[model samples]
Target chain A: MTIDPAAPPPRPPGRPRSREADEAILAAALDLLIERGGGATSIEQIARRAGVTRATVYRRFPNLTGLLVRAIEWEYRNTTPEALSWPDVPAMVRDWARHLSEPRSRRLVRRLYGTVDDLPELLRAYDAAYGSHRGRAVRNTLEHASAAGELPLHCDPETLQLVLSGAALQHLAAYPDTTAAQDVEAYFLAVLRQVGFPSPPPAHSTPPRRSTSR
Target chain B: MTIDPAAPPPRPPGRPRSREADEAILAAALDLLIERGGGATSIEQIARRAGVTRATVYRRFPNLTGLLVRAIEWEYRNTTPEALSWPDVPAMVRDWARHLSEPRSRRLVRRLYGTVDDLPELLRAYDAAYGSHRGRAVRNTLEHASAAGELPLHCDPETLQLVLSGAALQHLAAYPDTTAAQDVEAYFLAVLRQVGFPSPPPAHSTPPRRSTSR
Candidate 1:
């Protein structure tokens, strides 16, 4: 049966029970994860929240870890796939700003990072699924920037990626209340500039020369 | 009662039970927090691990949240008090390198970041307890660097701090197995130089002048 990804499944009369149940389960798991944090979330709680029987949930997901992984996959499935095709660094930066502005996104990321110790597999699964792809996209953009002379001579793309990721995490941590997308974008741009990434595409400028080694 | 911070109390014979219990409870809580992650930890589990009655645990810590907060406090109490008096950026950097080299420390930090959504109060208590003082120390160091002309003309210490904190978190995430202190120090120094922090105390260098506005 064909399923529309965006449209909510039609009311009980027409919707496929299996697909509807899957969405409910995934959404419920995500909600519980964000609301209570991951530690307190349980299969029983998820089942209850989703309005589905434990047997039904178990039929689909073997365990809580599997369910959590699927739920995260569902949550990010929409965004990460297209991230690789993003046209330029600025567009990616804008998207990052918009996503980081959402309180839910920030909370979700925090919860994910929290899983590193207890459920290393969950994060590992996530990284394998989407993080690597997203990383490649960013690296491609950075290499393009380096080729275009937008980055400083000493800047390594790999190190820049680390610094940029760190800046994003730190910005989220330090300014959780700053929910404005523009504010987030401004902060990101500042970090980029501080790391010597020329923004707004400096026009008619000479290629960057390596600063003299001290 | 004056309790010695370093030595474990004399075993059972003339030792005070309350202090011993407190130590056991705190230690157990920290262990569980690091080992299993925070969500799965419970008072019953902590009490069991600590070999104390739930009532005994409850008598000291009124609730799980309070207990968790206290556990975190106890975890950091020994180190934070001395952090403010660190002599210079290099000393602090070396200490940071040493701390990040420990797998336990990396896991603890990831777990702490994870708490931002579910148990923000836990992190907030931690921040209030130690993070602010640490921030002041870093800020003071950055200001001293600026005064000494060790930073670039366009550098903002606040932004640099954000970038540095982000970089640390990213480094921990990206290279969880790089447990050598020297390697971590090198990564940190590279980051510092990338951000224009002029490491190895540049010999008699002229003060930085602002790069032309883009």
Candidate 2:
């Protein structure tokens, strides 16, 4: 809970209970929603996790379903439509690797897809969030790369993005279970190497572009 | 219904009402299942489509729900676990291209994906059907390509399959309104070209083998 330091003074001696309780409740709800699928997650459980009284939770959300809708909305409040000012190409590359490696991010993906069978509406919302939010930034960064002559001369921006994201999406779908971070790292590196990233190229050895062994 | 020539021939009485009715019902049920989707499609609609009495439809399938399950099964009766007996790699390649281009195949894919939201159980069954029935053959064919020394030295069979199928799957999911055959043919060809298919390489030189333009 962030208080507006410039505009607001302390209302009273006690902490800001409303904002703190709201954040805690949403965060805890998010955790349970992802970790426990739909059926096991309940308002009581969210209240226990948030360490707020049931009355406090009820005040914000009348029921469990309503809380779930809000929890997802809260989680997505700051998600950039795409990569936002990712420093540079290398940082952007590293960003993808880090997401796969980190426990929380992986769990988030697992939790999202894990609900597809049981809660298709939730999955639909997830798709809407996932599609526009992060895609634009990555696309912008890739376009910048092409403009800067950092990509192959013939590279189509959409095609390159499709290859990179599409390849990763396949693995993510095939293995909904938590993946090994190291394996994912290795996989990312290999994908980059194969695609022939122009800057800070990994190795000298890549196959002939137009091979014909048939 | 085929009459065995060696055995007693069919009595020249009349058409087999039961078998004919069953086939007509199943065909109509499939059409409605895919066209109208799960909601509006009902036993009454199916009976009308089949030009059969409501009683005849009921005798064939006791209820609408039971009919839906059987309709999917009937549609998949001829599906091979993989490309059944292709002449060569090009033929195997053509197999995928044809599937994407042909109306029936594309419609089948569209209908299957279109059901994910409203009919999750059907989708789950579809995953089971699609997974086991087709994945093995593609995997086998790709392995054969690698064994033939036609793949890039650094190629991973699994990754290649993932990229090809995953990329195509993404497009197929996005556009279900029967994509133009030429567009799909081009898409399939581009996918194969990028994947570095060695057999009968296409015109035009490719990018630098180990491009480091930066």
Candidate 3:
């Protein structure tokens, strides 16, 4: 008997689309990306590892770039830290640095840079997502510090944003493989101190209270 | 008569490997690089602009990458400041920023970044050239500043090198089109001030005293 091309494939009665299939595909894509880098990963390999037919993969993503973008978005959504309620300026900046310096995040960033030259649209989307999410948190922290009189009075939020984000991004670019989380933290603290943030008081010492005898 | 397959061509009677031809080709290459970025220029164009035969260009430099590297070296040699003496640390840093912020240098750097992914050998050559010239100058400046009490005592020269070079490189990358030389100067000044360099004395209306009044 001839199969009908227009007909939908038969499924088990009352079965919903499997979320597990989506996860498996994305996980397979990430593995391929990390193993082979952006240039070498192919749709065929991804489909094979996902244990899905090529039709299923293509139905989800029209092209490799689409699949890659979706895979990145999934990874980012899963990896991003939960909303932080920072207690102080120093703590907030440190947390921001920590989030950026994580190994998975660094790998994602490198992959983004690798593809940026060929896929300008993808780069724009990545930047928009990054700016909307991480950028907002950084700006909020800077504004809070300014209001608390912790940051220099002359500091412009935009300039500070450029300095912090640009420096962090440049550090990643310059040292693609070897930079560590603590290195990022130290650099952040140095930048803060350079920009006139007062160092936090030493935890080990309590100053003597002035005598009220006079 | 058929030319011998393995024999080298004899030099023309009147032209003894003209030095002028080499200089003209190099000058044309530099001009093209500055005006048209890297990807658009070719050896044929360089030869035509220099009023030399394509064979002459090939004879001087076997490949395009070699030609570009030599052009960079020539540019650096010709443009680098001859006066080694720096009156102050801040002035030195500001001058370095100003040089890198120039349009020609910025274009050269962008071109270098473009080729880095495809031509790892060329990248290594560029790095070596840069390190030998600019890196040495930077190290010397930091050492001089430290000895003169201009730089802070605690700053490691190597760490300072990475930070300063990374910052300067990123500044070029960020503002590739603008003639914002003053922005770079201001940035270097801000970095200097942050690192504890003494700010220039404020302007005074009255004439200075010859002797101390204390």
User: Which ranges of candidate 1 are over 4 A from the true structure?
Assistant: A1-15, A79-88, A199-214, B1-15, B80-88, B199-214
Q: For each candidate, give its TM-score against the true structure.
A: 0.81, 0.57, 0.62
Candidate 1 residue lDDT tens string, A1-214: 8788999756786458789899999999999987876667899999999999999999999899889889888887765466565566777788778878998877776666677666676677667667677778888888887788867776778888888888877876768655699989888888877776667855668789888996
Query: How many angstroms is residue A122 displaced in model 2 relative to the true structure, after the best TM-score fit?
Result: 12
Position B68, candidate 3: lDDT: 73
All models, DockQ values?
A: 0.46, 0.13, 0.12
lDDT of 3 by residue, A61-119 (tens): 87887887777777767335356546667777778777667767666665555444444
Report each candidate's C-alpha RMSD, comma-separated, in the order given.
11.5, 12.0, 10.1
Output the worst ten-in-a-row residue range by lDDT, candidate 3 chain A: A114-123
Which pairs, if any, clash in model 3? none
lDDT-better candidate, 2 vs 3: 3
Instruction: Tell me the lDDT of model 1 at B95.
Output: 73
Over B13-38, each residue of candidate 2 has an lDDT whose tens digit, in order, gives 64577778888999998887666555
Error of 3 at A90 (Å): 2.5
